[model samples]
Target: MKDTQPADRGAAPTTPAPAVVTGKDAGRVAFAAFVGTALEWYDYFLFGTAAAIVFNTLYFTTFDPATATLAAFATFGVGFAARPIGAVVFGWLGDRIGRRPALLVTVVLIGVSTGLIGLLPGYASIGIAAPLLLVLLRLLQGTAVGGEWGGAVTLAVEHAPPGLRGRYAALPQVGSPVGTLLSSGAFALVLLLPKDDFESWGWRVPFLLAFPMMLVALYIRRRVEESPLFDELLKQDERAKIPALEVFRSAWRPLLVAMASALLGVGGFYLLTTFVISYGADTLGLSRGLMVNATLVAAVVEVGVILVVGRISERLGPGRVTLWGGLASAACAFPVFWLIDTRSPVAIVFSIAVGIAVLSVAYAVSGALLTELFPARLRYSGVALAYNLAGALTGFLPAAATALLKVSGNASWPVALLLVGLSLLTALGGFLGERMRVKDPVATG
Candidate 1:
């Protein structure tokens, strides 16, 4: 159990009392963060998927196909570009104020931005301003997302029992699969509508629905206590005077490692989900609904792989699993492109499922792996900055890969080579990242 006694000014808070938060409290925190993140990402990814499949026709009708795609994805990248800024601003508040409050603010920001997108007038109704408005909203969404994960991960991991930190911390990451399920399900549900209606109104419904779920997430988050570790740090006056700066000066190496190692999971996953769906449909001529169904199967496989990989990390360590997952991605890249090109529904589903399964090894351990990268005072800042920047690097990956495919005319070959190159780099970094976890001082500190 953590020591609960408050420490003297400038001292780290005394560890909270043995309320080491074993069963129920731990579960509550994890569930709150996981569910909240699920809803948040559902809104965010829904937009990405929509941008990939629906936005060009809905908003950027004036540009040629290639140009429209670039514009659409650039807007999509806007959100990621906003993340590091959000992290610095929000991370300071979190370190200075508290995690729960930061979480509440981020969730509302995301919910409002996403819901507003549903109501925006398209290009047909309101020229030039349509895509411009979307880029603005995507920026807001990106900012909110920057703050969301740091708070969520801090809230869950800080309250977790000492030995089981990895398993408990893994809980929040479940949101990726959950959000993937809901977003794709909503897209699938609306696919039942006629093409005209689905494009006209159906897409809007999913974004709007995020509001009700956001309210629920807020209620759950409001009920949780601040991090016992952080509270103890505060009481002890051990807080860094400038945490974000401290992290940069003291722990830049780990931050870089975190960024590089993250590509195997986050970057890879986005390319697999949002970009692949767009590519399979637009370039390969697969039906929108069928492509969505294939993504759904992959999402299910992802959820299962997430759970299994989390367990595997507890035993073999995240770095090892992540290394292997990257290797798997490298090996599977050609096969994935081959399956997509086959145009057979079964082939598409099988390929996507295989890709996600490989990526899940990295996904399952990412939160915990990142958390281990820095000390408590700078953990949020360090993790948030690294995570968001990695996001920024690959933020445009889908768009870039799609364009590369279009330009090369051999879509499968170019895309496969790109994935393999990235996977190998990510795997090499993960292998080196193994050293970062040796006696994780962050949780204990």
Candidate 2:
């Protein structure tokens, strides 16, 4: 597709001419994006929860407590490392063919990988082969996830009315917290089982549920129309020959801004939920249920935050909302840790919930901000690469935080500092993103 800049410089650069979608069509598209994303993330987050609570013992049984946990987390990080690979592959397909086809493939890939995880043998039965298979499946999950958010965000944003893109885009972002709630809730229920059963069979139920969830997501996704912008591109015969390469060659700056903006949402989330859950249970001697419950509550809070912020961003602008949210999260970093350090259940829950809420403010508008960074022809590749590259970089945060905790003699300072750094990076990205959209014709185009 010929890359064209918006003619009206006074208007919001990302706001294209309104698509012809009716209110019902827009809602259906947004809902489809939300459902498919939620299911994909459910599969993804289940692994994080399992790494903290189950994989260390079952898959890395030969190691010491600390080493085993680290190993499990390493495997958890492996999925993240594979995300960019998926991004490239699916991004290419989305840009070359259509967003709907790429999304259908990703959902199936994630569901199958996640369901197989439920059926796989652990180290007890399969020895080293168990962890190897676990890593392989995690890679597939990561790859699927890498392609998921970009397509979901692009489809929703492209389908939205000019002024309502933020709200429509935010709908897909809501899937993150929904996935968290479902995954954590499933784990909480399974945790109530007898110890042996919970370890052997109970833990697998959540992963197994992916089969049915996948079918539902697929059905919904199949009903949604292709992105209106992609349809325009098709009619115009404007598809990029190599979308990923084009992004790197011409849109590298926006890609960087997107990655920086996306880091806290990806990394900060893992730090709060995955790392904190392990820290609470293992280091502070808190009950696992307490930790999981805290995340469940936080997930609920995040859903509200995302919806509220999405609406606000439509007025204030997504970049400004992201900047404000990032700054707020940075300011809360120390207090969040201080509260967690108190070893009180109420304090822990409050800390986690409040932290997630603030971070979610930036996260909620990410789809709108990112989609605006690239023209429609390269939107999938650009958005997918930016978001998943950030995922690849920060996917190891939980494992890194665990090591930092041990290195700092269990002090929370290092971890808090890490949060501060990530929040600041996001703030910078938001600041630059808004300015770029205004001043850089390439990005706006």
Question: Model 1 misses residue 28 by how many Å?
Answer: 0.9
RMSD of each: 3.4, 4.3
What is the TM-score (0 to 1) of candidate 2? 0.95
The number of the candidate with the highest lDDT is: 2
Tell me, by TM-score, which candidate is best: 2
For every model shown, what is its TM-score relative to the native structure? 0.93, 0.95
TM-score of model 1 (CA atoms) = 0.93
Q: What does candidate 1's lDDT look like per residue over 292-322, in tens digits?
A: 8888898888887877777778778777877
What C-alpha lDDT, on a 0 to 100 scale, does residue 324 get in candidate 1?
Answer: 89
Locate the minimum summed-lDDT window of 10 residues in model 2.
436-445
Residue runs of model 2 more than 4 Å from their true location after superposition: 5-22, 438-445
On the 0 to 100 scale, the lDDT of residue 270 in model 2 is 96
lDDT of 2 by residue, 1-445 (tens): 2355322234222333323554558888999999999999899999999999999999999999999999999999999999999999999999889999999999999999999999999999989999999999999999999999999998998778667888999999999999999999999999999999999899999999999999999999999889877876676666777788878977899999999999999999999999999999999999999999999999999999999899999898889988998999999999999999999999999999999999999999999899887888789999999999999999999999999988999999999999999999999999988766521111112
